[model samples]
Target: MTGPLAGIRIVELAGIGPAPFACMMLADHGAEVIRIERPGAKKGGPGGDPTKDILQRSRKTIAVDLKSAAGIGVVHNLVASADGFVEGFRPGVTERLGLGPETLLKVTPRLVYGRMTGWGQEGPYAQAAGHDINYIALAGALHAFGRAGDKPTPPINMVGDFGGGAMMLAFGMVSALLHARTTGQGQVIDCAMTDGTALLMSMIWSFQGQGLWRDERGVNLLDSGAHFYDTYVCADGTYVSIGAIEPQFYAVLREKSGLSAEPAFDRQMDPRGWPELKEKLSAVFATRTRDEWCAILEHTDACFAPVLSMAEAPAHPHNVARGTFVELGGVVQPMPAPRYSVTPTVAPRMANEQSDTEALLDGLGYAPDEIAALKAAGAVA
Candidate 1:
């Protein structure tokens, strides 16, 4: 339990996607994360099966019926002993559940309250229900991510849910946590997916301002507008992504891929040459299977790599060398990210949910008989 965040305690309200992932990442890096689950809701149940939801990877899961006064009180008790709390829900739901910041912060004045929502707590659409796609669409992220002539393809919710939602919420919470530790004052983090996604587009907006990019999708330098920056389907129908933006890297890509020392490729940044250069690169790349290309160009200055699937990515040579993935509960899952050399990360043991309701209560200064009474009342599960 003693690593980078040895004394930090975070209580997460049971939810989906980014909330759990942020907690898992936090737990992986040595935060004491206690996930508050609804009573009888099976742990790790999101992967359509309780055992397969690997993202629900860490933390002590305690099912509490928030509708019960005892259960609501339990959260307040936990908050009092916690440095932060993370919850992902539509705006107004937590306040309606009586666990709102206004109420809980009164109990724990120095607790950092982290709220994750698609539209944030005060926006007009804050109360509306939405998923990753809806949030991305509102952020102009969906519009900026497609082929010139093709409909925008969703990027597997990485842009919205995990990147914008969970990660941003975690960041805000941690920032507030650091602040509270120094000043003994708590704050609320209002993390919105729309806001986070827009933040992700800052560089893209810069390109647009210089007229270097089109408002339309896939016509920008990094948005597959240039042939040198796109994926090429090889002979075996697998893809090799090439992103040699610099002239030095592009030169390496051209020479190794056997592209002639042609005028078009030589002029690496010419917008008029993108289509033709892309076509030429496509033809050449098609001559080799992905494997063949990797053998030739991977790890070189070409900035090329075989676009491996999730199953294939774990077993990749470089990734395996780095121990980027680990097998857990009979599933191959990604290892805890952002490593620490001195204070190492540890995998959560057993996928087990262990919270001595009495012990947890005792940590919050509750007596044995008080915890027993709450359990007898069917409040804590």
Candidate 2:
């Protein structure tokens, strides 16, 4: 607990995907996050061990049965001591559970209440059941991610869940917390995945507005249309990405890849010649193995990088040199990101449900008998 957010305390309403991810970011940077897991929570259950769930890392967990009045009271008490609260339930779920902002605000006026949802708190689709794909699709992000003549591709939950939903909630909470510190006032943040995803498309939207981009998929400069800005399969069937958009970098790609003399590639920015030039570049790239190309272009300004698989990424020379990944509890996962100069982050620890429950309740001033009584009442697990 020694990073920029060292003194912050957050109460997380345990859920899946984005909610946990958001808290993980907060906790990684040294917020004291207490996760409230539902009693008998079966998430990552069966063969799914909680220790191996990377998203649940770097936090303490307590299991509370929200269905019980005592459980509701338990969360309220925590809220009073906390600086921020995070929940990803549908719009009205917390309200129904008696832990809504209106109820909690009375106890702690400076609490930043963060609500994560797919649609928004007040929109027509706020109550609708949807996942990451559906959320990004509605945000105009999904329609722009595929090759020409191909169906829209889902970027696996990254674009909506982690990028849009989780990151937005984390930022909202931190910003609101700062505001509360300054003004002595807390606020509710309705962080919608759809809105966040749309915000992520701001640069692309601007390109469209300026007539520098097309609405069609795969036809834009940053998409797969530019031969200089796409991936190519090598003779070994492995792939490498190129983003030599600038003329100087593109020259390096041409010289390093032996495509300098090719006439079709002469007009680098001509849209009409892109398709034919792409075919020629593809043929050239396929002539060499990925490793062979990496040797010549990997260190150059060609903006070149081999498309390493998950197993290979951690072993890459640059990543190894930077300590971008770490092994914890015999599990290999990414280290906390956005490095700090002072008050660096501690390595993440494994999550254990109810492991800190007794101590946490004791800190909340629950007598030993009162804690036993709550456990006996089945309000805590």
Candidate 3:
């Protein structure tokens, strides 16, 4: 509770993926986030401990039967004291439960209501079921992946789920919160993964608009098309990434990898020769082990580094030096980023299973008898 968002309070309807991720980010930065789970809902995480679920960490949790009127009342009471709220259900789901934006805004006029979805609140495909892959595919981002001749590859769920969906919702929540604090007028943020994915490709879209980029996969400069801007397998069968996009950086790459005398590399920007140049560069890179090449090219103008895996990334010297990852609740997860200068963030804690239900209700002005009655009636757990 010692970060920039120390005084902020958020109420999150329990969900998977992006919604929980957004709440985790807010909680990591010191927002007091209360997660409401459905009674008897299956616990999620590694094994059965929801606390170990990295995305669910750093928040207090309560279990309530949303079907019960008392449960909706509980949420309304929580909303009255919250600065923001998060939900990831399909459009109209919350409305059916009497917890929609219109209802909550009436309870707290200064609340920022954040809605996360793949399609959005209203659209032709809004009601259709989809995940990260489908959303990014529709956004034109999935079409930009993979090799020149290979079919478009999905870059896991990072692009749509976390990058476009969760992060955008978190930013919207913060921005709307700021606006509310100033103008006393709250707003609803319809954070669509498809829209966010397209926004993420603004640079590439600009390139295409200006006729500087082709509308094909892996044929662009930033894609795997360029010999110097891609990952290469080494003699040891491991990989290293090269990003010598600029002339100076490419010169360093050529010098370090002993390709400086090759005349073919001079046509660096020529797309027609990229395949042949890439083959030649691949052969050169295959001559050395990944670590050997790292020694020659890492920390240089060559813009090179070994392509470390999930198990290897945390141990890398650069990541270790920067504390890019941390161990919490015996779990290794990424640290909260974009370091703050003045109001620094605190270490995150594990998610508890309704450990603070009674306390939260009491704080919300529920008397002891009323809280006991609600529990006895199976409304809150």
**C-alpha local distance difference test of each model:** 0.83, 0.91, 0.91
Location of the lowest summed lDDT over 10 successive residues in candidate 3: 42-51
Deviating ranges (above 4 Å) for candidate 2 = 45-47
lDDT of 1 by residue, 1-381 (tens): 646877789999988888887888778778888888787675665544545676666676666789998899888878878888889988878999998888878988898999888898886898899999999999998998889999988998999999988888878877898999899988889999999999988988898899877899777789899888999999999999989999899889888987756766787788888888888888998998999999999779999888999889998989999999888668888887778878888665435554445567677787888878888888885
Distance from true position, residue 373, model 2, in Å? Answer: 0.4
Q: What tens digits encode model 3's per-residue C-alpha lDDT throughout 96-154?
A: 99999999999999999999999999999999999999999999999998888899999
TM-score each candidate. Answer: 0.95, 0.98, 0.98
- Model 2, 26-112: lDDT tens per residue? 999999999998877674433367887888898888889999999999999999999999999998899999999999898899999
TM-score of 3: 0.98
lDDT of 2: 0.91
Alpha carbon lDDT at 163, candidate 3: 95
lDDT of 3 at 13: 95
